[model samples]
Target: MKISYLLILLSLTLGTPSQIDVSEVRTAYIKASGDEQAVEQLNSKLISVTTTDDKVLVAYKGAVGTMMAKYAKGLKDKKSLFKEGVSLLDYAVTSDSLNVEIRCIRLSVQENAPKITGYKKNIDDDKAFILKNYNSMTDEGAKKFVKGYALRSKVFNDNERQLFQGL
Candidate 1:
């Protein structure tokens, strides 16, 4: 009985998924742009996320994957990582089309993605979506996250940035 209980306890501990804090992910994401270590750490934390997990978490997983591509040494590995990330991001968007946070995440990725990657197609659409729906977001944290990103996004012109002011 002791051995069986120990086995069960070990299995339970090993099988449990790590808990993701969305706020921490958001904060890490902001740091990732300038810090490769932050990107690697966030990617490691999010690597276990699957399609069945929360859509927002899936989106972060995708975002970190894309960021990881920047640190990849080989061109093939970089392209592969980017494509996989974009695929996951697209899946999350499809899963929750109306989620403004997801849209913001995609916009951040697309805006910064190289033009040669052909992943820039959604920039205009996502920008428009974010602009139109940003005010409707009920979560203060979500609003702050979006506003923080928009304030720094190159895609948002001076006039557009004004919309997110005083948030």
Candidate 2:
């Protein structure tokens, strides 16, 4: 009886899924743009997950999926990955339209997506939304992460970038 109980307890512990950290995801996202390893790491972490209930995680999952397209070998695979990533991202946005971080993630993807993908439609709207909502955000970590991305983004011109510089 004792052995069976111990085995069951061990199995239950091992079967529980780990919680993903948003801050860690944010850090990985920043590195993912320039690092293929970061992208791969994020992909592996988020690929099999199937729910968008956690909006931030789903958004990062989408962003990482989109970024993975650049590393894909074949054109078809590239398009498939990009499409899947964008689909997840869109779902996240629809689920939580007012989440600034989600909008920021979408903007990042849209701004960098190729014109051929036709995924650039939301750039202006997302950028405007982010700018308008940024200062009002209460999560300092999120604000800092978004500001860091904005500083390096091509869509945010000199004057626009300045808004994120001081604070």
Best by lDDT: 1
Tens-digit per-residue lDDT, 93-142, candidate 1: 99998999999999999988988898988888999999999999997877
User: What TM-score, to 2 decimals, does candidate 1 have?
Assistant: 0.89
**Candidate 2, residues 40-140: lDDT per residue as tens digits?**
98777665455534887888888898999999999999999999999999999999889999999999999888889999999999999999999999988
Off by over 4 Å in 1: 1-18
TM-score, predicted candidate 2 vs. hidden true structure: 0.87
TM-score of every model? 0.89, 0.87
Inter-residue clash pairs, candidate 2: none
Q: Per-residue lDDT for 6 in model 1?
A: 100
What lDDT score goes with residue 63 in model 2? 88
Clashing pairs in 1: none
Per-residue lDDT value at 27 in model 2: 88
